[model samples]
Target: MRVLRYLVLAGLVATAGTAVAAPVTYKLDPGHTMVLFSWNHFGFSNPTANLGQVDGTLVYDEKDPSKATVEATLPLSGLDTFVPKLDEHLKSSDFFDAAKYPNVTFKSTKVTPAGKGKLKVTGDLTVHGVTKPVTLDVTLNKVGPHPMMKAQTIGFDATATIKRSDFGVGAYVPNVSDEIKIRITTEAHDASAEKK
Candidate 1:
């Protein structure tokens, strides 16, 4: 009977360990997450646009970071180029055609640990009704309790270069530059944590 009791206790301990090592779900904080992209214009200068109001969730496993996954959506309505006419023109059919495809989205298919606090995230990016595979080099900035929000938060900075022509947003191609550089910064709060 004593031997059986010891075995049961061992099993319970193992189960508890597994539970503590499981993945965690974190919801992106829209107010703290933003996407920025820049493109070269006729070899003269580079123009940037900021996109906000991102909605997404991230499933992260600190014990096994390779299993992490991320999905995000950015509405075109939130895009700002700091120029009203430029923003309107970009949303028009000449560019993104926001009336038809109003949002840009990305869903990770695989995540690989690159180095200390770094990951290579490969995902499908949908833009202007076209979907393409893109890889983002991501660096984990920090993961801890937020000072103001009073919740556990994880932050990351990611960057990627994509060709606009490949996504069917190829207006003025070579003139406006087909390649676009994208940078994303996000802070996600643990969904299971209570905010005080």
Candidate 2:
């Protein structure tokens, strides 16, 4: 009976080992993902610009949040500031120099759980041909099935602040408010769900 008990215990251990969940990869929905940035204009007002056509992938492990990772790309070609003349100037050689450095990117290096449904993501942000480390405060808004798309989906809202000078985009430091505030909202869906 002792040998039988030992055999059962070993089998249970093997079963438990195999039961560990693997990470799930979700594709960011370009239509729903948006990045907005605002900066002070000579202390008069804050002007905001929108960046669209965002694409990326997020890997998440529910069992171990630390194993999560994020990689995203933002195209400057989609930048819109509402003012046509200002938009032309921003995309010119004065500010972002979008013609030379066409894309901004972020790749997370570490992910730490801050609290329930919240995370602190540390990553390298590349803009205007310069790279700098930035930390984003992220909230996991929801993770569930999308009723309309009929797929598993996840949503996140994140915020961060960075100095334009750090990324070589400082055209007017004090006047344009050296610091820029950024907000990002994204919805991702499991690409594998489409096969079902």
Q: Of the candidates shown, which would achieve the greatest TM-score relative to the real structure?
A: 1
What's the residue-level lDDT of 46 in candidate 2?
98
Question: Which pairs of residues clash in candidate 1, taking residues 3 or more apart in a chain or in different chains?
Answer: none
lDDT comparing candidate 1 with the true structure: 0.93
Residue-level lDDT tens digits of model 2 in 86-193? 888889999989989999999999999999999999999999999999999999998878999898788999999999998888888899899999999999998788
- Model 2: per-residue Cα lDDT at residue 113: 97
Give each prediction's root-mean-square deviation over alpha carbons: 3.4, 4.2
The positional error of residue 183 in candidate 1, measured at the CA in angstroms, is: 0.7
Write the residue-wise lDDT of candidate 1 on 116-137 in tens digits.
9999999999999999999999
Clash count of each predicted structure: 0, 0
Evaluate all candidate structures by whole-model CA lDDT and list the values in order. Answer: 0.93, 0.90
TM-score to native of every candidate shown: 0.88, 0.88
